[model samples]
Target: MVTKEVRLQSTVAGLTADGRVHTLSVWFILALRLMMGLAFFQSGLDKVLSGEFGAGGYLTGAVPDSGSPAADLFVAMGNTPWFVDFVNVAVPWGELLIGLGLLFGAFTRLAAFWGAFMMLLFYLGNWDVAHGYINGDFAYMLVFLSVAAFGAGRILGLDTYIEGYEIDGQPLVERYPWTRYILG
Candidate 1:
């Protein structure tokens, strides 16, 4: 018993150019998560395998000139063996863990939060506004923020199941309601 008007309404409102069909729509976010995750994972893995890879040169270079506020801190930490060593270990491990968490959709919001925080640090540490006030790290931070805000994990990630995960007597969501903020 479909009428011409009903069919016309269905066709007209089915989709928009921005793909705002529903809030759960995350087809595009899935691709973005995979891409960002792989980028981080590869960078970390490369650093891990590179035998001669040292944080000295990179940290030294990250030190901005007289115009940057972090110049002193970066300079102070640059040549320090302990600092370099700590960064060398922490950077790779953090990247790997965050990348894996994002890619597998495990602890997705937490991962993305950390990802954004790390990117924010990079953004601050590498602030070179003297050039143009634009940096890729800032852009990456925004992407991570967007993914987290959109609950991208529910699309094709473990978050979907974890969100609805139940326990022996009460559902995990019921027992630990705070998981709603953490997992998604």
Candidate 2:
């Protein structure tokens, strides 16, 4: 009987531990969202402020001996005038928006999805052969996917408020049907 009682006590302890973990996980995502958002925002700002920044140099340098398909895409796009022009503007603006969305916890999943996409490109573009260490992009991709999967914004974001938003005494859905994706 004592052994059965001990087992029951241990089971209760384990259940409580699991509950604590679930409760605390949101805070971790909140931290990730803030830090990642700031990092992306700063990178974009640096590019926007720099007068001589161009994607061509980086893209051209991505030529790889391993014959990565990603390398081929970068090399091909490096020379096109339109691609260069578009990338130069898009990189900064896209980073800024993604950062804002993540920081504010508005459209958290969509922003995280794009962030992961950008990280994938970075992962491919900067694959180092000599260095055995995994690149930062892989970590960033997982972080983004986690954020989206957990809906990190709801914990400490405008998203929670947006869900409760009322416009002119009408429900959020009444005012705009599309906001469900952004708010949720």
Give lDDT: candidate 2, residue 89: 89
Model 2 misplacement above 4 A: 1-21, 65-67, 129-133, 167-184
lDDT (tens digit, per residue) of candidate 1 on 15-62: 633322433345778877877788888877777777455667655675
| Superposed Cα deviation of residue 134, candidate 2 (Å) | 3.6
TM values, all candidates? 0.75, 0.76
Clash statistics: count for each candidate: 0, 0
Question: For candidate 2, what is the lDDT?
Answer: 0.77
Shift of residue 133 alpha carbon in model 2, Å: 7.7
TM-score of 1: 0.75
